[model samples]
Target: MPKAYSYLRFSTPEQAEGDSYRRQMAAALDWCKRKGVELDDKLRFHDLGKSGYTGANFTEGALGRFVDAVQAGEIERGSYLLIESWDRFSRQNAMTSTARLFDLATAGITVVTVDDGQEYSQERLTGPDVSPMLLLVVKLSQAHLESARKSNNVGKAWADKRERARAGEHKLTKRAPEWLSLEDGRFIERADRVEIVRRVFRETIDGYGRRTIVHRLNEEGIPNFRAGENRKRKPTGWHASSVAKILTNRAVIGDFFPGTGSTRFRTYQKEAEPIRGYYPAILDEDTYWRAQAVIASRRRVTDDDGRVVQRGAAGRRGSGVSHLLTGLGRCSICHGPMHIINKGPLPRGGLYFECDTARRRAGCDNMNRWRVDEIERRLLKHLTYIDADAILRGEASHGEFEKVESVKARLADAEKRRKNRAAMLEAVEDMDPDSLARYRELVADVTALKAELAGAEKALAQTAADPGLKARLAEAVDLNRAMGEAEGEERTAIRVRLAEQLRQLVEMVDFHPELSIIAHLKPRADVPADQVPFTYDSGNWRLELSSDSEPHGIDPDIFPEEDPDAVRAANAFFLKRRLAKAGGAS
Candidate 1:
């Protein structure tokens, strides 16, 4: 009897856990019985709900790990890799799929097609008058060809749907928000769910961030929106990213952009005209646009080099969003945002932060790290002690708009440069010796400049269009009272809610000499610099940044010297922060 193993994959969880899985298993067992092969149950690999079209199916999926085991000489040389059919192995085209089949053959493993009792071994695959490629072309089952062709055709269909959406001639036929339900093929907002949405929007506009909003909703025991049902899964919990999505959705403003993918996806457009009367809007235009601007501004942090810092991709997978302050730190010297570092899944799963520029060796010498857990605790403690009156009101400095004007000024500069380059190109002759090289450089420069200009213009437009949202956003936020009102775990949950409120009121924290943490109060973008009364400008910033550090600083009790690394990081950290007025700020 020969040794055998089985490989199984299903594209959807329903199929993986349903009759498809059972039928595939029966076929493999019957094949083993017929061939008198001893099937090793432990060697069976299951790529549950993993697609086979991508090479990842064999390279990085569970099947890939089996390949790794084979390479490690765990499986016997003549072991059989049993599967239902060719399509079950991979949905790739015949050429690529055959090549992967040949790889296993070369490794001395025989691939057995259980459905037909066909065995593919090294000798049978490579014989006289038989080029493996040509043989596969002639012999690949029609089922495999159809599967591959269908994948391509469906992609093209999605392309067609997207184009139709862009033309505003099509609307998504899939699931709408829970607040919206399809009644008689028209979208109608449920009054109950609409109230929930309104409360979410109001809290968001009035200084509540995503995580806090999620917590507030969960604490209220509200049911989250679900697209479908799954018996094996846990009940849906409101997620910060989900709340963030609701806040930023243009559909709330009566505008919708239908997007295409395997699943019907929706894209958000900042300046698109609303699809009039197609669906009732849950939020007025001003509030919708205002929510968008705030969300965009929070993600628009730039390093000293003027490159945007990317936030995590929707938190850590199934873990949902972490606390708000997780990625908000900066290295005062390198001027790049800090990124979280982890100790993997080893003995102690410790998480910390380090300067990105230094980590990448991009030339700044600010090597420092901070324990994330400790930092989160300190922030909570800091919020506990802060006075509510410190959050100054009555100024137009709703933090969303301050960052916009600076970006606009930069955009204006970009536009001017683009025009200058265009003019120079107009004067140059194509036949000239330096013309081609200059043209190429000018074209690339203009392209980059235009892209930057387009982004800045869009952001400025979003901010410009919404005075009403800003008014609502500028409503007095009392972080102290909000924190004080919480009784148990809710009090500690201030990490995100207070962080969101602080974003608009407080500009950023600058760590200064003697471990002093300076709170820079943001000024209104509309407030003129000459009238604002400040000696030094924080780089073209017009409004005065009142530092509140002398009163409310990082609590001394929370500070600790964990190790030599901590000491070194602390020293470098402060040295960078205490640099001269001309010194860089991350």
Candidate 2:
């Protein structure tokens, strides 16, 4: 008996939950049973949510695979291809759909529309029966026309909605940012989600990196806003990318853009310009821009000669901050990054920070190394005791915005120059060599100035939005306390947080040839210039040892009343039993 393969396709995924799947499958099975052919249950072809009108089912879907298999002889020539209707195979243009049908028939594969019970075999298609071929052409053409009309109507509907939204008639669909909800045709902030959004921005502006924010959110058991919405898989906990999206979304500052894509895919191929003040504001403009600037700064750090001193893969900072000072310290001799090199394992063989150049054996023989555990502990302890409010914020001057003002001035000057050049060109009536050169120079200057202005403004906004040095130091002190109390993976996460904080706070850590480290702190808007670079050295700072080094416990009693051999055997037996129990529990 010949095998019959059933092909089912639905233009939308929602139809899978309806009767389309069952109706099509049942028709195919019934046709196979009546015709005395075996239905091949193993090879199931389903193209869910793929558009037949766009020929997606043929080009990028399972139908295409089936056709290829038939042509390659992997599927036997005399088998049958079963579909509920011709439209289920394709709603494409008549010529294309006709060619597809004839190709399958010519290859000795019978095309069966189970709904109409039409068997379009090779003999029927190639024989002198004009009615069969004309009927197929008519059906395909009708399907194509119907799909085209529907696509047009849907596109127009969405376009009208976008226009109405622009005119402020109503909110653009029920979908809003994860922090918002739709109610009464307007968007309202969800309290819990809005708080999470605020926390993401606050932490970012406070110099906590995205990974640190992810760790903190997951540790606190905050529900992920998108967890329930994803249909493809089970919910994953908070991720760094999710935190980054929250921090950078312009929707938080009330900006919205409506766009359109292909009728089938629904992704944005053409996005309209953003409409300012469209959504309800969740964060101030300053906070949003500051988060952007801080996120940019954390991406990469460059040295004085314009060489990138620290960067991880995929244009992102390494999520793993294993060493306390990874990406924070540099070689005093060559100005290269310092990294931790492990000698072997624990107590005797330890980890030490080695200069990158020295480690590569390229140049700069600064063989001095600092033991990781001792330095980290000492540095953390010193950070906890510092009087940040008195030293950093008390007499601080607010000059960060001056940079923005300077950039604006330069941009204005460039625009004036461009306008004057245009006036001169109009007066001249003909383009000379110097005039053309001057016009080009003016255009170049304006373009460069505009880019610089954007950067300056963003940096200034970030500076203004930041919570200042005092707050950051207080956070560091708290983190230190937490880290001191935490162990295992929790301790590692705290270290990552501290490392990100230190990278933002401290300008550079210089490992000298004298076996000492000098940390130069970055200047802040709230700190006085005379009080900075806030230079400090390991030699000047001393680590105060903690007295609670060990837990209180009594010494073991050596004397026993039972026979020594029997006692030893019983103790060994119980120890083995306890070990077995522990393994089982794990």
Candidate 3:
């Protein structure tokens, strides 16, 4: 009696949940009973939740492992391998699996499929009988063509749905649960969880840091969703990353892009593309932007050792240092980072900045550095001068601040338009296909409009609150002048003001006795000189020009005294001579 191993597979979730597997198993067992084949109970393999539509080159879960075992001669010769049909065992594009099956037939295994009523004998398998091969080839070709057609249909449907969404005529396939609902149709927010979400966003945007927010939330008895209800095996508490994700999610801002078909259908298993959202926003656009800007500024902050100061970590200690210069500084010589360095004790250390490239790379002659205090002083002077002049010229009037209000109004308008489009799309979800297509076209138009609106709003907001631009034309010019002149606590206030405006420009500062000081400036298009004030002297040679001396030609034999290499050699020779004299004296 030949031993038989039954293999079964289903392509989709619907098929798995249906009678597909049972039907395949019953047919295979009936064939085994008629053929007088004794099947091994242990070797019966069934792959549920696995797709046969995947090409032959890809492995089919447990089926792949079983095949590997058979190829390794784990099963005795003349064993029967029974499956429901070629399609159930493999798909059309899987040429490799078909070839492997042929090889199994040659190895004295009887390959049989109950659905097709076909049997592969050793003589037919070894002799290359073209009929079975042709049958498989044709079936596979059909499968491949069918698969392509299905894919095209799905893509078209999704495209049409996206269009309808844009036109205010389509409804989302999966509605938000009772806890959630469409706000104007673009954002996903829970009425019950709105306060929690808002708090999370607020903490993150206000620079409280994600981890701190998580801790605060936990401390307030606001447990993890599962834990709050006192459920057994409660989920872990909220994390910083989760808070950060919420802060950045466009879903909160009332946008929905249709996920790509490959993800929607399990065909390619690739990442989905995010389409323009056609839904109501939970958070206002300005609020979303505020969070983003804060996040960006936080990312740019670094500690005295030049390492990034991550969120939830203790912020860098300083009298006044902004978080907007974290990773932007570069060495003038080697184009490496110019990090912050403190020369004294903790908290009160005199801070200086220098380029890491000059310290590491050989032959990098540039030595850039600057004292933090001195740099800040100069920056303040320049800012104060600019501010005072603007005030005197009446440039720092109420008119400038009115732009902020104008931008706020524009933001509100764009948001209103977005919501209206979302509502329109939701109203026509059950329309006819032709009407749906037209609706989708309209949705696409709205999508484009919303995108433009978003861009305009963002630009306007940036311009309104631009510290750099606003500083050069401040409405509080007199106050700025007074603050600039103020000392101690007053100076600290001015420092904060200047810090907010100039934080993005100054990245870091490093100081060394040999290299002096270096300052790393931001790569703004307007600011040309990124390297800060510093002096360089490499023991024997200094990069200083003699203002009073004239250049003269010297003979190579009569070397210049200040030549670094020559000086080193002379010192070495003198040291050796002194050693000889000491030996004689001894």
Candidate 4:
């Protein structure tokens, strides 16, 4: 009996016909019985979903592996490689088909086509008579030509469908995920998930910083998309790249781009490519552009050489002081965070703050440093000058008073409108269509007004009636008084308060010894400098001669006389000496 291995393929839906896998297997089994061939179930191969026209690209499929096994002599020589027909075997390029035939003949394997009734083998090709071989090659080439034409037709149909979808015409493809669905032939967002997506976009646009936003979202218990049905996967934290993606996604704006291919050959094309817009947009184009602007305005920090340092690694030092300056101060040159360092030994350590930018970036002119003690002293003096009486007596500047008054007036107006709208709505039962419509308009206006009113009231309450204000002011007064008449822990508490308040107003504290200036002010440009009510420096405490002059009592000459090199050297020597002393005592 002949050893026979069946190779079966159905390239198209028309070819499948009533002859599916089960029918084809039965036919192949009957053919084996009729030919007196031993058909091994293990050797039976089928490429059901794979296309014979693209056989050259095949790998790991049943037909591909069968060809590989035959070449490797895994099957005995003279074994018959049975197939339904030449086209079912392959309709690949002419060169590929010819090469495969040559390989099968060289290996002593007999290629037998059930439908064509042609047998191919090395023994049958004596002296290149070639008539039978040429006929088979011509038939295979014709099959390949037909397959190419069909492929082109299919691709053109797909292109037409894609173009129509891009024009906002809906064509049913695959259904969306179970949690989402199409409405009015467009993707209508699920309110819950849509809100989360919108929030991600909003946070990215607001410049909360990617990590901060991620932290906030996770803190709020927002589940990530990939989390399983019952298992809620909250955002571990937002990465900057993730935030950037959310900000740039067109999906939020209600546009959908189809995947490049159907399920069998899916691909992702470039986002900017023309695509189907099958969904209603949740965000406007202007809003998306605004978010991009916010992302652009954020200033990222870098080292002295203009290289960015990872946020986690930057400002890792300083004994509980660095946190105070985290977002408040940055290196003027590198824009890196300033690190706080204590200059002297423990039990009497003198503190100073230096910009990480100057340390990391070579040749940065802004190697500014400030004595922490002097900053504290000057800040205390400035706090004393604030005149607690001025705030308590409502003698604060007109601008400050007006800010509070404006919020109050807005809140009152909103409440009044809400009341008037409520009265109008009550009379709507007796009104005609026009009156009812007018009443509804008033109701909407009142609802909006009341919402604004609530927000205004909250702002005013935070500014005017905040418990933190009185407590902070009292703490500032006590600290200022202690600086004049206390030592040790008492002074440290005062320094902490000064640092906190100063941070709220000061963007960065630059210490430029080269310029003989201890503090370089980058005040919030919106707030008047006079409103800050403090001068900063590394010197003896003094009230500002004028609201604008240096607040510390030390003359400007004092800073010029003190060399930064000397100060650093003194600090280093002091640290080493303290270390030696501790070692010796131990």
Candidate 5:
């Protein structure tokens, strides 16, 4: 005749899996059937693994949800709430329990305590002053006390367990860190996971960023640290944030903060002191801290929203500026990084690559800025002057076909020298009247000659087989085309690509007063960028353009003087640098 909603609750997972849930459900169902009340399964609400002592059930529990709906008039005023007992409705404090019951009764809905066989309604609860429901209040009060007692017992048991852990009886709880295995009341490093942690830290120290490491790990299909292996679940993958956590975790260093402290049940450990020697360390303290230092160093200065703002030229490549030479340009005098600054009405190649030192008030006499279009145009003309395309074509054929023979000849000569030296070294020894020092020197020379011969032979073999020349020639041809033929976005993309390529090719470009460019050639091979010996050898060439004596201070596009020889030298430098990078130049 009446609509009755069933409320099912399980305080613990064990209870959910046990007969308690079935018994509670059966009681509610049987009571409804006896009363001939229609009970729809849709109206059955379940809140499992929730504690009765906490009022979180009201906010998060199914019974509390039904009560909430009844109070909010979502349920009809005459609907019934069927619970196993008053205690099942709530095990809150005496006052709170009584207040909630009164509120429920006042809302004109009936609360059926099936186990206790008690029914509370608005009419029965009506009294002039207090709505004298002595029996219900007493029952609720008993339930509240029982909940408090059980909560204290649970807290005591937790304290006992933590004390046992503190007294070296067992680990703090059931499980330890994933990298650690709890064996016989002690934590030992899990070998496989330990290796994973070591790799993470090592990768971090090697300058691989967290996100990059994550991508690499995912690419390699390396599974992450997961507990439920052998259980039927999807495999978890690595993430940047998770990698970051692994990097920052101190537990990998074999120190574990057990988090055993003075607090209530399930509370945060306040004064945590890590217990060292709990497990074998995956990484030493020095390596761990070194990684931490680098990680700290890379953390950029961020705005309120965590977006990095460029303060100085520390790590800023000036991605905001779309100019081709923004990152590659360098101040000739001060050696500070050059940033792109747009001046004039703009788009007439008005973009200026100026030194950041002068702008930052780090007073420098060379406050000169180079124009983008002027530099690009000069650069192109310089490439044409050197006939770089022809040099590339010639170099390609010579490296592939011609140079191998010469390298072989040199290699043969070196091997002959090595053999002669080795023979001399063998003949000498202690038996000869010559000094031991002389014999040792001969041995060293033979060793050197042998190494040199090997290098020459390798070089000859590489020259004969290397296929890198075509790509280098193609890149150079593309640069020439972008400078001479292309326009608009196509030209811009090529220019930017060329700029990036040149960045890897040339070390830094130094601007002179007359729009003259001097790119202090950065080495392209194993040669270091700074110590690019000032040489005219095509293999390790440096660029130096002639400058007008005084500053012209006119438009950058306007050439101070048409020096064809200077242009050829500069273009040769560019082509040589590119070839050096391509590993096709001898």
Candidate 6:
């Protein structure tokens, strides 16, 4: 006796819940039993939820594998290929789909269509009769045409929905971020989940990497929010990739992307232009971008193969090591990395930061050994908050403030012009060609200005939300407090987080041969690299203006005019006497 193989397929997964799956399986089994052929139950081929019109079944699905086996001599030559109909195999192009059916028949395998009870064997197909081949072509052509009409209808329906969504008459999708819920056709932030999202962003802004944040979340046993509430299995713990996606997702800032590709029968789609203010914002744009800046600061520049080609000072922030400053420390003489060297034990021997160049005898000779614990302690205490008061007093928001005011002025002017134009038009009994043209021109101008103003205001909000400077300082303060309270491994973790935060503030720590450590602080926390070097000398216990030959006081322009007293105090913190650098007063 010959063997029979059943190949079943359906376009959408929803069809499995309908009569498609059961009907096709029953037809295949019934036909095989009646013909007295052994059904190959071990090698069942079913392309569930796969599209036939796109030829996905014949390309990547199980149907393709079945055909390949038949052609490769894995299946017997007299074997039967059972399907519900010709459409169940493929609704692709007429010529291509017909070729697939005949290809199996020519390979000595009989193709059986159970619905119409038609069999296309090598003998019958290559016989003198033209009706069988003509019928196959006609059936496949009709299927292709039917699929094309249905595809067009669906595309148009989605286009209408998108247009309506843009007009605020409809919502584009029911799917939303895990932190938000789709209620009454609108997305609302879930308070509990929203807090978790906020914490992730805060941790990132505080110099905690994605892995660190994921570890903390998992250790705390926070219920990891995921999609598909009806899923059988849920994530037991947080993942680094999931945490990274949450940090980078624009949906947190109320952005909705409608995607560029056709999503009707597809699972994944490419993101197109974003629809702003689509959801109730869980995070301000500033907090979102600040977190992005922090992430970018720690990200090492990698090559095509993900090999680290260049690394910033903060690139080694979350290496799970006890070294406080690995990438940030540089030898003053050779400008090489200061690597930590362990001697013997705890009390008798401690970890020391040795210049890698001198230790390895590579290029330059500058031997300066600084105790790791002492360097970490003094740097955390003195350097972390060196320019905290100045930053928190609102100096960074100046540039963005001016931008908002400028946009507001232009917006007001546009509004006034629009009102004047409307009044003039209403006063006229009959509008002339010139008057109509002028009215249209003013309307466009006012609309463009309004849009500009909205963007300017959003940028201003992000500026006011400067999580970079103020957040870093607040994080350092908390870390300092936590270090005093924490012990053992927890203290070490806190030290790593503090070092990451310091990397955002302090650009470099140079250890000279004379036992004088120079701490070079950056102009701003948000910037990863800067040419302007603000130095704090351990020998003098004071902050210097720059590396220039002449030293000057703090710039007056940075201070807001409303609070002169606060400005004077901030100036005093910088110019006044302070603790020495990591090595202490020389």
Off by over 4 Å in 1: 129-135, 141-144, 163-170, 210-242, 255-280, 284-286, 292-525, 535-586
In candidate 5, what are the lDDT values of residues 1-586, reduced to their tens digit?
Answer: 3488887777667787889988988888888889888776766687775556677668666767878788677777777888888777788877887778778777777888889667788787775545348777788789889988977887778667655654556566646777887777667777888888888876554445567577667877778876458868866688777887888777777665554323333434622234455556777765676566445434435599954432121233322224444345666677666777778766654778777888888876666766776675544433221223323232223332223333333344345545554565578655544224434554565566567546655665555333333233334444465456867645544443344334324445676554456655443232223223332422234455334311111123332234434433443455466556547533
RMSD of 4: 18.8
Evaluated with TM-score, which candidate comes out highest? 6
Worst ten in a row by lDDT for model 5: 549-558
For each candidate in the order shown, give its overall lDDT on alpha carbons: 0.57, 0.67, 0.53, 0.54, 0.58, 0.68
lDDT per residue for candidate 4 within 451-476, as digits (tens), equals 75466445544454432332233434
Q: 1-586 in candidate 2: lDDT tens per residue? A: 5699999997666777679888999999899889899999888889976778888888988999999989788789899999999999999999999888888988889999999999899999888988998998899999999999998998889878876786788676677899888888878889899989988887665445677778778888887987777478866789887886886577998878676664465645534245567789988765666556555545566689978755421123344455656566678799887887888888778889889898889998988877877666655533522332322222213335435544555466567767876776788867767557757877897899789777876666566554353233343345545666878755655554455445545555677776556665554443332222221222222222222211001012421313444433433443355456547868
Cα TM-score of candidate 4 = 0.45
Which sections of candidate 2 miss by over 4 Å?
215-242, 259-272, 300-310, 313-325, 328-337, 341-351, 355-586
TM-score of each: 0.55, 0.61, 0.54, 0.45, 0.50, 0.64
Count of clashes in candidate 6: 0
Ranking by TM-score: 6, 2, 1, 3, 5, 4
lDDT of 6 by residue, 39-108 (tens): 9988889886677888888788899999889878889899999989887888898989878877888888
Among these predicted structures, which one has the highest lDDT? 6
| Root mean square deviation (Cα) for candidate 3 | 16.2
Model 3 agreement with the true structure over 1-586: per-residue lDDT tens digits: 5588887776566776779877877887788788788778887677765656664323747667666777797888888778776666666465755676777777777778788778776776556578876776777667666766887898789878876876678765565422256566544656667778777765554345566577678777775544556567666888766776677666666565554534434543311223344545567765676555545655545599976543222344344333223343455455556566667763556665566666565556456555555544433322311233322342323333323333444344445545554565578766556545544655565566566556654554445444343233232334445655777744544443344334433444333434333433333322112111122222111111122211111123433333535533433343355456547868
Model 5 CA lDDT for position 151: 70
The segments of candidate 6 whose C-alpha lies over 4 angstroms from its true place after superposition are 12-19, 211-242, 260-266, 304-307, 312-323, 326-346, 352-370, 374-498, 505-531, 534-586
Question: Where is model 1 poorest over a 10-residue stretch in terms of lDDT?
Answer: 264-273
Give residue 250's lDDT in candidate 5 (0 to 100). Answer: 73
By the TM-score metric, which is better: model 2 or model 3?
Answer: 2
Candidate 5 C-alpha error for residue 260, in Å: 9.4
- Which candidate, 4 or 6, would have the higher TM-score against the true structure? 6
